[model samples]
Target: MKLVTRAGWGAAPSRYDLAYIASTHGTKIHYEGAYVPKSLAAPGAHGSCAGHVRDIQASHLANRVENYSDIAYSAMVCPHGTVYEGRGLHRQTGANGDQLLNRAHYAVCAMLGNSGLVVPTDAMLDGLVDAIGWLRNGGGAGKEVLGHRDGYATACPGDPLYAWVQAGAKRPDGTAPQGGTSTPVPSSGGIARYQVVINGLSYGYGAQGPHVAEVGKALVKAGYGKHYQVGPDENWTDADTKNFSDFQRSLGFTGTAPHQDADGVPGPVSLQRLLGHLPGKTVKAYGMLPFPGRSAFVLGKSNPAVVTLDNGLIRKGYARHHAGAKYQPGSLFTTYTRDNVRDFQRATPALAGDADGYPGPLTWQLLLS
Candidate 1:
């Protein structure tokens, strides 16, 4: 089997080694035996890579931590065509049947397990061919690869895919290998927001009602509004209108008509600006910095030089911890006041002149960078 490191793949038992050789008597072919989306593969075929393999590994580890006994397989074949060594071929996994049949068996899991997502990817098939060839040839005592349900009661490895496994194929030199094509790096662009915690409270960016107080606070700090109030009920109020008005004004709307309840309530255009829809305005947020600390806001415009300087420092790991969606230091204008700014200016040589500490463009640049 082709074993290498990649995302979704880091666990234990790095690769097939002498430790594995001693314990494993033969090879057992089992499907992660789960289902996966077709998008997992390339456009034309089911070509997988180390990255895809790693995703499966990460999920498996997460699953094991949640409920299972241990990682379910000895090794797995990602759609990317990479084989990952599970608990090593030597260490026994609880994925197989009773002890007698489990020992001496090297299990290989096909990514996506057996959930019934789609036809197996060609790359996955190639991986299967390569893995079987390696197990049958390299292990000396050649053995047959079987589905999970073959010995157990469950319909593991699914029906359609498992049927194909029952019919074996031959190998030349007992190995299959091929080159790979390029694929784009995965991004979390459209992912759904999960409950993000802040100051011991649970909230989501898309949530509504009292939860919106946090969102409103984020908006105000981001420079979308000026008026913010803490109600007797501790809930956010329409003081958010100021932010909506500021955003609307930025869009070129003029006079009282712009602020009027023309559409009854705030429209999508208004919300869009709050969410950074409109262009040019700089929106400052608390960032992912940890609590009990202060977050800096870079105002005016987004200067590339400033941004680059800040990012460089962040990359070097000097900035405060990431707070996700929470704000800290309470009132930026008050808590930071003069003392905080003076302290910051004193500590950082980047700010030469006034120890006044009030962070203007240059001061903010120096402090953030």
Candidate 2:
């Protein structure tokens, strides 16, 4: 039951906004409905699996929705027992034949089918079961795992796999492993707008609205902000300029002249640099520092880097001062965030030994996963 996260799969992002809200109705299974040689299904053959998804998305965007940002499946399982994240946790997928019906359930596609030549091995079946289990628990899915034929007028998920889906998509005992997220590295393409949203893609004096606030928040994250004693806000003042310029210069930028000193204006280059590593909980949100600075996240640190850790903690249901308390959005790190990071580190097998409440590179990777 090994799982490959979205980043691990090296997916090319969609050019469309993610607007679909997922349902808890259960999972619908499907297949590529075409032949893929067994060699593509070999163990660790992640390249083949990723390539297959990309090709399908190209077809889906061109023929299905004409501008669909991504592939139709919520996720896909390979014959090697690895699950590749597709549209991720939220966002409605374009799989269902009925556009309005796409909200009924999540989609899981096992990379097989069409020519009826590739058979699903025992490992592949177990992988599929594990994929369903992960989606059911992690992404708020229900228990009624069914094939595409169950809800749509299509002979999808294929016959043999369809029968397996009906048989509860159960795995043999102890066959599945927990999903994985590896250490962070550069993404394969341009940074996702969802990952970082700046107003008009830049910020300066007189900018107002959520985008201005986003810039202020980013400034706060970078250990800047001489004026945000109460927290960053939408109003752009001289303090914003000072802090932004300080942050810009900190990145090694030095503007000279009567109007020198980096100017505190967030052009595209500086703005992307300040986003750090914080990802929004939903689509189309303004972003933060692109690179959170070059330090390990720890307690007592009150910067944009803390926001990165806080976002991760919030996502896994471990954030908040106490039970039933909502996390203060873009707030400074508190005891609660630290404790949750420690708890998550302790819980993760790969990170159990390093559960010191200080989120390093590996911790961020796992949290993103």
Q: Model 1: per-residue lDDT, tens digit, 122-238?
A: 566667676655555554424556667767776566544465565553222323222222122121332222222222232222334543564465566667656554521123334
Task: Please identify model 2 stretches exceeding 4 Å from their true place.
Answer: 43-47, 64-66, 173-369
Q: Using TM-score as the measure, which candidate wins?
A: 2
Instruction: Give all TM-scores, in the order shown.
Output: 0.39, 0.45
Give Cα distance to truth, residue 188, candidate 2, Å: 47
**Candidate 1's error at 195, in angstroms?**
35
Per-residue C-alpha lDDT of model 2 across residues 114-187, encoded as one tens digit per residue: 42123466666777777778777777777677788986787677656776665556564433222221112122
Cα-based lDDT for every prediction: 0.43, 0.59
TM-score of model 1 relative to the true fold?
A: 0.39
Instruction: Report the Cα lDDT for residue 317, model 1.
Output: 42
Displacement of the residue 17 alpha carbon in candidate 1, Å: 14
Q: Which ten residues in a row have the lowest lDDT in candidate 1?
A: 288-297
Model 2, residue 172: displacement in angstroms? 3.9
